[model samples]
Target chain A: MSHIIKPILYSYWRSSCSWRVRIALNLKEIPYDIKPVSLIKSGGEQHSNEFRDINPMEQVPAMHIDGVTLVESLSIMYYLEETRPQRPLLPPDFIKRAKVREICEVIASGIQPLQNLTVLIHVGEEKKNEWAKHWINRGFRAVEKLLSSSAGKYCVGDEITLADCCLIPQVFNARRFHVDLRPFPIILRIDRELENHPCFRSAHPSNQPDCPPEAIK
Target chain B: MSHIIKPILYSYWRSSCSWRVRIALNLKEIPYDIKPVSLIKSGGEQHSNEFRDINPMEQVPAMHIDGVTLVESLSIMYYLEETRPQRPLLPPDFIKRAKVREICEVIASGIQPLQNLTVLIHVGEEKKNEWAKHWINRGFRAVEKLLSSSAGKYCVGDEITLADCCLIPQVFNARRFHVDLRPFPIILRIDRELENHPCFRSAHPSNQPDCPPEAIK
Candidate 1:
C-alpha cells in the first residue's frame, strides 16, 4: 500500500465533475484539502500551463492522492473507491455494481461532457445553452427511466453509491441551466430527499469555499 | 457466485462504445452471443419500447450476463472484470489503474459522446463533419499527450488495458470523420500495432455479424 498521504483536490465550485469528486470524498469521510481552479477567471485558469502540467486535459477536479496525480472526475471517484474500499461507495453485488456504474456513465459520458466548457466554446454563443439543454434533456430522459427500476432513497436502492455522487451534481447542473426538472418526478424526488444527506450536502457547489458570491445568492 | 450464465451482448457493428465492450469480452476470452441492435436501419431498433425494456438509454452495448441486464459499455466491462478476473483489463497498481480509467473517460465521455449519433442529428448538415473533426481532433490532442508518459506497446504499458479498449474505437471513428492523424503519432502507432491483435481484430466492426456490406469493403 502507498503511504498514508494527504489528498489534494484541484477543483472549481461549479464544475459538475468537480462536485462528483467532492461527494465521493465526503462519502468516504477522507480528510482532504481543496485548491480552487477558477474555470472562468482570467480566461480560465485551467488553461494555464501550470495547471496543464497537473492534468494535460486541463480540467478541474484533478487530484493528488496515494502517491499519484489523477485526472478525470469519474476515474478519480473509481480510484478512491478501489483503494479506500470502506464506507463503500459501490455495491458489492456485481449486478447492482454494474447498474451503479451505468448511471455514472449516463451522466459522466452521456450528459456532462456534451455540455463541457470546451465543446460549448466551439458550439459558439448561438447554440451553447441549446446544446447543453439538448444533451442534458436527452440523457435525463433515459436516466429517468433507468432510475425508475434501480432508484430507492438514492440512485441505487437506498445506498449512497457512486451513482448518487454522479446524480446530485448533474441535477444541480440541470437546475442551473433551467432544464426543467418537472418531467422527471423520480429524479426530482431523489434529489429532494438528498437535499441535506450530509455526504452530498457538503459537496454541493453552493457550500464550497470557492463558490462565487453571486452563486451563493 | 452467480450461476454460470451465457452472456448476451446487445451491440451494433459500428458503434465505438459497443466495440469497447466487444474488445473486452474477446480479451477475456468470454464466449458471448451478440444481439444486433441496428442503430441505422429503420430508424434505430434501439429506440423500440421492447429494446427500451432492455436498456432505458436506447443505446447499444448493453449486456445480459450472470442473470442480469447491464447497460453502458464501461460498466459492462468493469462488471466482467469484477466477476471474471482472469485476464484483468486494469493494472494492479492504483496509479496505473487511474491512468487507464482516465484514458477511457477521455474517449468515452470526452470524445465519444460529443460525436454520438443523437448529438450529430442536432449538429445538423452544415457543421456535421466540422463538429466531428473538431471534437475528435481536440480530444486526440489531449490523449496523445496523456499517452506520452504512460504508453508502451499498449495504452498504459505493454499490457492491454481498458484504455486500449477505448483508444482503438475512438481512433477508428476519427478516421471515419477524416480527423487528421498526422499529429498523434503515439495513437497511430498504438492503433497500427493493434491492427492484427486477436482481441481487437475479432471485435472490429468489419468482423461483426451485422457489419454493413459497404462497410465490409
Candidate 2:
C-alpha cells in the first residue's frame, strides 16, 4: 500500500489460477501489470529458465509485489490481503472468514489441482476428459453442499469474498471440460450473478489482454 | 486465545492432511480431542452423511474449534494461527511470512492433491504407484529448490513456520509412496531435523490413537 511501483503478475490467459489473481487485483482496485507466461507456447514458457527463476514451480499467478516475488495463487492473495487491507477479501467475523476459506480450499486444492494441465498431460489423451470430469463433479458435489448451508447470493453470504475468486474460475474450468452444471443450481446461480459483476467481468479470461482470438466467448 | 470447550478434530491416521493439522495443534499447544474418520473401513467414513454434515467436502482434518467446524487442512491452520497468536507459526515480517506460505502452497495445492486417495482410486491399481511417484518427484523438484534458498534449521529458516507443517507431512507421503529422497538433499535435511522435534514426532500417524496395527511404522 506504500509503494509507487506497480506490481507485476506472471500469468497465462486460460489458467484458472491466474484468473484468481486477476480477480483479486480488480476487486481490491490495485494497479498492476501482467507479464504473460504462456503455459502452452514454446513447450510451455513457464519452464524456461527466465520464468523458472521467477517461479520455480513453473505455475501461473505468481506476483512481483511488496518488493518481493511471491509464487502460488493462494499465497499471493494472502499477501495482498495482509498488506493491502482496505477492501478486505475476508469477512470481519472469524466464523464467516473460515467459511469463506473452506470454500476457497474446496476449489483451490480439492478441485483445480486434479484437473490441472500437468495432471491432464499425465493422464494422457485417452483418459483426460474422464479424469477431469470425475474430479470436477466430485469437487462440485462438495461445493454445492457447502454452498447450500452458506449461500446468501454468493458462495458464502452476499459478500464477494476470496472464495468467489476461486469459484468462478473453477466453474469456468468445469464447463470447459463439459462437466454437467444442471446438478449444481446453487453454484450456477452464484456464477451467473458474479459473471455480471464488474470485478469478475473484468477478470474473465476473454477480457484479458493475452486472450487468444479463438478463446473469445 | 480464550476458550472453555475442548476442540474436536475429525482425522484419519495416515492422511497427510490429518498429519498437518495434528502438528499445528501440538505446536500451538491447543488441547483438542481427535475423532477418527477412517478413510478406509466401510467404503470410507468421510462419505457418510454424518461426516458430510461435518465437512461437506467429506475430507479428514476438519476441526471443531472457536465454536464452529472448519475443514481443509490449510484453512484449519490459518484459523489456529489467527485465534491463538502465541507461539506464532508464521514469521513476523511480511516477506518472510509470504515465503513460508509459498512453500506451504507448493505442497498443499501442487503436491498433495495429485497423490490424494481419490486421485489414486481413479488412477487405478496398476498405475497408482507410477502416478504417485511422478507427481511427488515433480513437486519435490520445486520444493527442494525453494527450501535450498530459504531453509536454515527448518523449511523457512530456524523458526518453526507453516511451511514445516506442510513439508513434514508431504515428505512422509513421498516416502510412503516410495518416491526416492536421494535427489532432494535439502528436503531430506529438513525432514531429518524435524523428525526428532517433539511437535512432529508426536503428530506422526503411527503415534495417533487410531493408527492400525499394520500401519505401525
lDDT score for candidate 1 against the true structure = 0.89
Please identify model 2 stretches exceeding 4 Å from their true place.
none
lDDT of 2 by residue, B1-217 (tens): 5377889999898999999989999999989899999898999999899998998787898988867778899888988888889899999988789899899888998989999997798789999999899889989999998887799999888998989999999998898899889999999988888898898999999999999889786
DockQ score, prediction 2? 0.79
Error of 1 at B130 (Å): 1.1
TM per model? 0.96, 0.97
Q: What is the interface RMSD of each candidate, in Å?
A: 0.9, 0.9
Model 1 CA deviation exceeding 4 Å by range: A1-4, B1-4
Could you tell me which 10 consecutive residues in candidate 2 chain B have the lowest summed lDDT? B1-10
Model 2's CAPRI class is: medium
lDDT of 2 at A137: 95
Estimate, for each residue in A78-137, the C-alpha lDDT of model 1 and write its tens digit.
Answer: 899888887999988878988899999999988998887878887899979877898889
